[model samples]
Target: MLSSLALLSVVLPSALAATTYDMVKEYSGSTFFNDWNFYGQFDNLTNGDAIFVTSSVASSSKLAYVDSTTNRAIIKVDNTSTVAFNDKRNTVRISSKDEFDIGSVWIADMYHVPFGCSVWPAFWSQAPNWPSGGEIDTFEHWNLELHNQMTLHTEPGCTQASPVQTATVVNSTDCSFQDNSNAGCGVMDSTDSSYGAKFAAAQGGVFVTEMAESGISVWFFPRSSVPASLSSNASSFSTADLGTPTANWPTAGCAIDTYFKAQNLIFDITLCGDAAGAASVFQQTCSGVCYTDYVVGNGSVYDNAYFDVASVRVYSVTGMNTIVRVSSALGFRAGCWVWGAAALSGAVVLFAL
Candidate 1:
């Protein structure tokens, strides 16, 4: 059955509500809709899921769009037709116009989140540099998982043991190359409603990520629970006022300022990648054949694969280059976009994954 979510009430601390943070960047409505640069293509060979099409092709295929309903950005996976096992599924992947560094807070207002079988959608942040710049997976939803995942990827010398908040479930503490690849130090939000169907049922809401001198933290507010100050009308939004975070990554064992730098916000939907496709359940559904076979055969399974984002706004303390006015359709490309080139062309790549 299709699920829809409602708003959750959030009680703001009296002391925090009085304060305010400057609203630096706001990506809402149609004015800034076209400012996004369309990615022609990107290949995640290490995961070995499927090939992605360019933005133009994605728009043509109804996988991506921006209009009245999608003025904020609506991206989805191939659900309109029966796909061939060999044929790649259509999807949408996009990045913000500008690069954001530490001490920035991002709030994503979503109406629908990606869910369903063989689906892996992520809204993460990363720098142009690979492991050096670091990556933070704010919300990575996999059909196989029951909770929301928050991970940080960086070079060697980062651990989640000390300084890490115990509110969430810590998987691996190491943010370095655990197995020649940055598996990342990650934690899971045990709240069932924090992701997927539960989140969708709540009508989706806000995802707040704040990177400060202390560490990185994430908060998810369902539509019913969004902070009053952050709703349609309020002076401004601030991290101090939001109370405690759902996921917090302190710097006792890690130097967040060192690893995490200027990064672009990203959103993408991938099918049968290294994580989802490699699972036994993923293979079991496809008649003992390949994961792609199941995904191709059960095309209707992806009918709910879509992202109806209402808003993506960024706030800053200093208010540095806050808003990103839309430039060309393909404004500026991030170096990280070419993450795996040689590996795709059949050659040795510096960063394995």
Candidate 2:
């Protein structure tokens, strides 16, 4: 005779085993540009009035470079040339050459992030096809906003049904690309130091994201509070050690495996486009028309529009096989449980008999 408790344990997967990560890629210092692909002259998908330059232009203009003194990587918007009205400001948008699937974790150690009127910057991941492939925004903000907004965008049929246990407030529960004018499901970190001027004042920090079949989670650590085990040279890390994340998307609400797919890491800074260019969103934190007042200026207003990155590390999962699908919420309710492999493949059949 099999006990119900024993049966349940055998049928479930262990969250701890699944979350352990081993470092696989590190983008840092002089070699940062080697692994990235410039988008090159493409129209801003967000409708922002910025010109994304090619790798040669970026290198020639010093728009993207490794600081010799600090050994840090810098990616910035052009602040030297005055642009005529209706013309686009030159900027940079780059994506990782390698893509990562589920059971992956990314940690970005940033010393500074872009901020200014009409400036929209983001550190995110996306599938090549988009909408259908899915998008995960690890860190994003526009204008002079004070907090980071993390979001997920996917094709129709995903929703945030389970409440997240984190330090963020949910802005929307729907993750569909068609709803909310394609806003997707978003949550805002509940801290002033998570973005904008304040974050820069504190010398920036780390943003960590975990993507798994069960769900996705994001955490922000101020430079002063970052764990010692996390750094540019870190070889491995355990997500279980990171306390409650800033935002969590559990599987109970959305099928993460179905909506999200292999994703390439990306970073970009654009001016007065898309979300930042919208009159309604722009008026809240900035003044003047988004295009006229900011896009045509001598570029002095964008002195702060840059990223000073210590490193970006990608870790792949280890020790756990993701052959079986499990509900993340079940682990939450059951208090950190794991099922044996034999049970996962054979126990269900025995229980049914």
Clashes of 2: 1
Predicted candidate 1 versus true structure: per-residue lDDT over 75-95, tens digit per residue: 887776776656666677777
lDDT leader: 2
Cα lDDT computed for each candidate against the true fold:
0.63, 0.74
Off by over 4 Å in 1: 1-20, 45-48, 67-72, 161-166, 178-181, 233-235, 281-290, 322-353
Candidate 2: Cα lDDT at 260: 85
lDDT of 2 by residue, 26-69 (tens): 89888988878787874436667888788899999989999999
Q: Which window of 10 residues has the lowest lDDT sum in candidate 1?
A: 1-10
